[model samples]
Target: MSIRKNVLFACLTIIGLLPLSFANAAPDDVFIFSGTRLPTALSEVGSSVSTITAEQIKQKGYRTALDVVEEFAGVTVNQNGGFGGVGSVRIRGALSEQTLVLIDGVPVNDPSSPGGGFDFARIDTSNIAKIEVLKGNQSTLWGSDAIGGVVSITTKIATSPKAIKAYVEAGSFSTYKGGSEISLSNDLGSFRGAFSGMTTNGISKAESGDGNAERDGFDSKTFSGNGLIYLPASAKITAAILYNDSMLEYDGWGAQTGVSDADVTSETEELSGHITLSLPLFKGRLENTFLTGYSETERNYFTSGSKTYDYFGDRLLFRYQGTLNANETNRIAFGAEHEKTTSGRDENSIDSLFILYEIKPMKNATISAAVRVDDHSVFGSETTSRFSAVYRPHNDWKIHGSWAEGFKAPTIFQLSYYFPYSSKVSGNQDLNPETSKSFDVGVERAFLKSRGIIGVTYFRQNTKNQIDYIDGWYENVNKVKSKGIEVAGEYRLSDALGFEVDYSYIDAKKGDGNRQLSVPKNSGSARLIFAPSKVLSAAITMRHNGLEKNTYGNVKSWNRLDINGSYKLSSKLELYGTIENIFDEEYQQVYGYGTPGTSANVGLRLSM
Candidate 1:
């Protein structure tokens, strides 16, 4: 079937189910931080946001952050090969480099990268408490690299007086994984720490069906810690740290042929941490926080057992934010930040100030406006702004809309890197920053005694001065436009059964009217969960992707099914297992890259 017909059918299907009686409403008290840089209720934010909590992560057995986000609408992920291979994510057809990734409120994009993009390959989900994805132009609050959206990951913290948890698993492809976590809390403070690791003799990076027989290998280790200290006089201190190390073997392109198996390996090490002090005054009517953060990444590449190239990137940040509650109807948030980034021997800095004003003019409405000004050491200054509103006419209905502007400065590598031996590619110092304007409007409704929720959103974005490799150098000579529709629904059929589904349709084009590459025009997922008792649970998920274009050719549409279940052996022990790609589907996300087939894993979990 054609793409248009498929989209029409999906839309009709959703419309057909509007009259059914179902219920699975989310809790009203749930709060998210990425929506406004404050703890805002999900219904109060106008921007498109998706959140995955710790319970959902555990129930789904997600091993990486990438695994969790791919299930959402309007998001796409591409991996070069099997486990530990390079991975990238795109939202609403934006480039991977345009998305800003954060770890505990700290930006973690690699400055040494050609486009300052973050690699999602090595980010495990061991210590994650929740993930919030804010879509559309978000530069008004996040600064650079927010042209696409923002992905904020928050690590776990102590919530109980004392707790300990551990898990171990082994699966196909000679894979093994394990993790342990401990937490302690008291009246004075709280602390939590976790460690996780994984190793696998993975499938060939090149297509194994194409006569490639060599097996690539991957290994990774991660450690995370968080602490909170209570101080006198309504003051507090918080600290967090994360460290990761990984090694991956990949394939190289042949001079005459395409992807070929080769002995190429890369090692990466990264460390990131932050400290914050919070103070409240005026009988808690005003609040302030000061923070300092640092991140460093090092990468080493080798071929034929000899080192070939290395890159280092680091960032330092200092920030202060204040919030004031003038009355029950008015509030203000203001902040200033200074960040310095270094790649190799070159460094640059940016200073920024931003403010947001929010007002509740009516009983069931909230409106907010924000603006930011940033001064870059190399490229002068840029300004961005956003406006948003949310209204609840009835107890079960919500209407929301947002308009925002964003900009991305040139990356250090894009502006200064030059290779004497490579004549085909080089950096252009005259490139300009890319700018974007975007808007989204959506409506959500609850029905069947508030046991079900359905929502539909329409979003559009236009970007100018897009930088890309043209002729022999990086240049700002392109423009792009993307528009999409997102539909999401959740239903509880009974006390023991539930269903969830999401679908997206995107139309993306370049200045020359060509469709964007590596973006699927249609995608969706559906899951059915069964929990007859508190001790036993199971779920089946089906995911589908439409046709996509790549440098080599068009990638055929594909579908995959996965099944997972868990059984509580006792009050302190549980057993779980999963079967992925149950039919052993043979498909590729990127042309010439290999994908896993019919993999299975089993594990035991202990809690105390």
Candidate 2:
């Protein structure tokens, strides 16, 4: 079938499945922090944001953060191969390096990489408490590298006085996975610890043709911990730490053989941690927080059991923020940050200041404005701003709009790397920062007596001075324009059934009006959930990706189906299972990379 027909069919199917009567409505009081750097009601934030909770992650049987993030609107993920491969995420056709990723509120992008982008393959879902994705330019609140958006990942914390949970699963490709978590709480504090590991004998990274039958293998382990302490006089302290180690076997490319399967492997290690202190004064009218964070990443590559290349990167950050409740109808937030990034012998620092103001101008409307200034060691200074508004005309209707500006500084590797063997290929020290401007407007309405909700948004962005390799030299000579529409809906058909669907249509072009490479114009996902009883639940999900152009050729469109279910054997024990690629579809995300076929896994969970 054609891409257009597939999209039409998916839309029609979703509409046909939705009934007049919907199920339970989402809570109105849910709060998110990434939207404003302060806790704000989801209904009052005038930005495009999506959230995934731990319950949803568990229910969907998502093994990695990438699996859950790819299901959201205006988001795309591409991996070179299966587990442990290099994974990249883009928002609204923006470059992967333009998006900022955070772990426990700390930036974790690799400074040694040419683009300083985060690898989604390194993040496991077992220790996550929640994930918040804010789409569009976010440089007004965050600093540079937020031109695309921001993704904040929060680790698990204690939710009760005492609890313990564990799970184990085994499946095809000689794969085994397991994780365990424990939590404790008291009057003075709470703490949580978690550990997870997985190993798989995977398929060949190169396409399964031309004598490429050698099997690749992958192994990974992660440990994370969080702690909180209550102090005197409305004061508190919080700390978090995470560690990860992984090894992956992959294929090597050769000029003569052209992506032939060869013996190659890589090992990676990462560590990140942070500590924060909070204080409240003036009878809780003013709040202050001080934080310090650090992160380090190291990678080694090998050929035929001999180490051939290595890289190391690290970052240190210090920040202070203050929030004041000026009046019943107004609030203000201001902060300063200092960050230092190091890659091998090259390093740079940035100092930033930002402020945000929010006003409830009327009973049914809210207005917000923010501005930020960043001083870079090498690139001098840059300024950005944002404005947003939210209006609720009726109890069940909402309208929101926002205008924002963003920027991204060149990475150390992009600015300092040199090629002595070739005069044409070298980093440009005089490159300028990339800049972007974006706008979005959206409307949402409740239906079936607030049991269901639907939302649609239109967005556009223009970027200039984009840095890219041209004529064997890095230069800021690229310009891009992107526009898109997003539609998302959720409904409850009955007490035992629920439905959710989202779709995105994007048109991205370069200065010459050529379509951006590897960006699909059409993509969407839909899921149907059934829970006939409190003890059992099941869900089926469908995802579609339209055709995309690559340097080699065009990648064909594809569709995939997945099903998962769980049965509570007792109050503290449950059984769960999942089947992926149910049709055994043969598809490829990248031109020469291989993807998994039909696979299934079963697991047992214990809680106390």
Task: Record all residue pairs in model 1 with backbone atoms less than 3 Å apart, i.e. clashing.
Answer: 23-451, 23-452, 24-451, 24-452
- lDDT (Cα atoms) of all candidates against the true structure: 0.86, 0.86
Question: Model 1's lDDT to the true fold?
Answer: 0.86
Q: How accurate is candidate 2 locally (lDDT)?
A: 0.86
Candidate 2 lDDT tens digits, 529-573: 898999999989999998987766677899999999999999999
lDDT of 1 by residue, 1-608 (tens): 13223433432332232322222322225364788876678888888988998888878777788888898898988888869998888889998899999998889898888889888889887788899888999999899999989989998887766789999999999999999998776666667778999999999988898777899999999988877766788687777888899999999995432688999999998877777888998988888989877777889999999999999998888999998989988989999999999998889999999999999999899999999999999999999999999999998999999999999999999888885655744567889999999999999999998889999999999999888765457888578999999998999999889999999999988899988888999999999989999999988899999899876677788999999999999999999999999999998888788889999999999999
What C-alpha lDDT, on a 0 to 100 scale, does residue 385 get in candidate 1? Answer: 99
Candidate 2 local lDDT, residue 206: 78
